[model samples]
Target chain A: MDRSGTMLFADLLGRAKTRIMADWSAELERANARVPGRVSTQELVAQGREVLELLQSAASSGDSDPTSAAYSRLRDLLAEMSRARAFQGFSPTETATFVFSLKKPVFDAFRTEPDLSPDAMSAGLWTATTLIDGLGLFTMEVFQKSREEVIIRQQREISELSTPVVKLWDGVLALPLIGTLDSERTQVVMENLLQSIVDHTAEIAIIDITGVPTVDTLVAQHLLKTVAAARLMGADCIISGIRPQIAQTMVHLGVELNVVSKATLADALALALQRIGRRVVSASPAPAVRASA
Target chain B: MDRIPILKMGHALLVTIQVDMHDQLAMALEEDLTARIAATGARGVLIDISSLEIVDSFIGRMLDSIAAVSRLLDARTVVVGMRPAVAITLVELGLSMPGVNTALNVERGLALIGVSVSGDGEHDAGTEV
Candidate 1:
């Protein structure tokens, strides 16, 4: 608490930076954090140095609490590092190791301070332990959040990709749904199909659900909602690809798809063509060979 | 008090809702549509909502009511050109407007109502209720 003690702590921290950097990098390598190719050793060392410099200044200022305003710069650095690691596909352990590996080098620095009493040495080591542990945990928390954001964004992209509305004919469109019909996905499916319907001036839309894995009550409801939305846009909807199992499930659930449905995409397309006064006729069979028999 | 104009095309009445329909305006449109349907003995009513970006449950109910009224008068109603966003919102709101018929555009809607786009009587007979 005295001026000399504070000055000595600052001097020790200044001397500890290089040792910590070297030891931390070696510790990370020992921990195999560099194996993932997510971050290069040089990049990791640079980041570690910046964090250590900030930590030394804050710690010497008597700001031991990681969550305090004094540690804001250190927190930002750790958060940025964690987010980068998360997006780069590093494991949470590896991300946290970036912070935890600093503990050994810091404690070594405290041990080299021979002028300090035994009690002061332990206290300094404890402060470093607490700060390092807090920083490590903060990195994990940020990693989790960033990973979650990545997952949610990927889910959105997948949902958008799964619902593709293809124009089967001038006035007909086909939407082949290939996944579970959750409420969010259903919203995407309906919006995409309906937008295509309006754009194509499609008279009929065939929603093929063969790629859909199951037909629960909720999924059926979402399908019906899509159908209704399509119909509202002045497009008749034909739900195709209702496998026998799905049909059975629908029957057992007593879910009536009030709209017309076909068992196959080809059947739905054929019917759609027929409704629009068009039909695909097979080309005349190859001229029969009179002497074949 | 803006009134939605109802244009007569052959034996069908076309109402293009280009403005945002409030409660009163929706009710008035419903009344006017029913009265016109009864007086003109219109065989089909086509309501175009392509320009409408939002259709809450209230407007959704109005569409249903209009369809029901037209059906009772022996006239078919086809709602056409509903925007995708509006349709999605309506479905999310759990108002599907089951009683109303929908078409992709006015041309197809007229065909559904038994009137040809070229004003021909070829498909008109099939549309009679």
Candidate 2:
């Protein structure tokens, strides 16, 4: 911990990191040469792990720049390699590399904006990095450790998302939107819902977002698309479970969604049943949806 | 982000969609989902959206491109996600959902189909249910 010793160590770490990065770039060129045009997913992923191991050890020795540089280089490399879908596999090393690539954006966000609020920070970080479904969005920060807990509270929402459509009624198909809709999930939701519509030839699609914590502009837009696409097919998509905060966020954002027919799940159900010309059994008020849950 | 099956479901197949699903993360979704939907041998598709929040030109165009590619495979298309708010906005903005069969949800959505969905549902969203 001596000042000179510490300073010398830091310098050495920096030089070593720079060297590793430079060497990695050279390795990439060699990899491309070996392939003659395209690098296989294995090569990209394997190279990614090599870079991570070197950087991680260097990181352990108080070398932020090299660690950061290694991360930057890896990010660029992955983006380029991502052109091929075959690179997506559960190889432990590849998985680790993908995780590193995903998280690096969050880390960079923090490093760049040292003065972000908690919510803004999370959203900023979330928005900055794309979360690929197979790629893990793990956080080293203590705060996000309870993300699993957050999902737990919203189990109903979570369940509904993965829930397969059963003909609850003769003509009704339901899609439960349990969690908040990020753009990525929204795409999945859009694909699933639309496919279900065509597959089932559904007349009623219920998107219940009771699990969503907030509704930002992106989420709102996803909702809008659902309703529109449904109408084009001569069916109706009812969106239930609009959290008050989300309503407020929509208003605050000055985005008008007056044309979309939105209501609570109770209302969505009633409307859907009516559209299908079916009589409902539950005229009694439905139980209150969990606000936190 | 786990688009395992979606990626596996590549071109010539098409399915309908009904939402304005977009964001930085959506790019990956489009890449994988489009690939997978194409794999299904749909020969046509329809995206019904009456629940979406916004339908800007960029998203509208993305839908069009997706449908156009599906068309090249001789797969017909109908863009279905069109909430009233979005429709009005799109009209005002001079945009269209373009080239896909859009419905309200699965009922009208599936009526256009050529294949049957497996009884089992796909619930994998990378998070446990």
Chain A TM-score for predicted structure 2: 0.40
Query: What is candidate 2's lDDT per residue for A214-247, written digit by digit as tens?
Result: 7777777777775565555445566677778877
Question: How well is each residue in B16-91 modelled by candidate 2, as lDDT tens digits?
Answer: 3333466543455456545655566654455545556766777667766766666675665555445545554553
Best by lDDT: 1
* TM-score of each predicted structure versus truth: 0.85, 0.34
Regions more than 4 Å wrong, model 2: A1-167, A259-262, A281-293, B1-129
DockQ of each: 0.58, 0.12
TM-score for predicted model 1 compared with the true structure: 0.85
All candidates: interface RMSD: 3.2, 10.9
How far is B90's C-alpha from truth in model 1 (Å)?
3.4
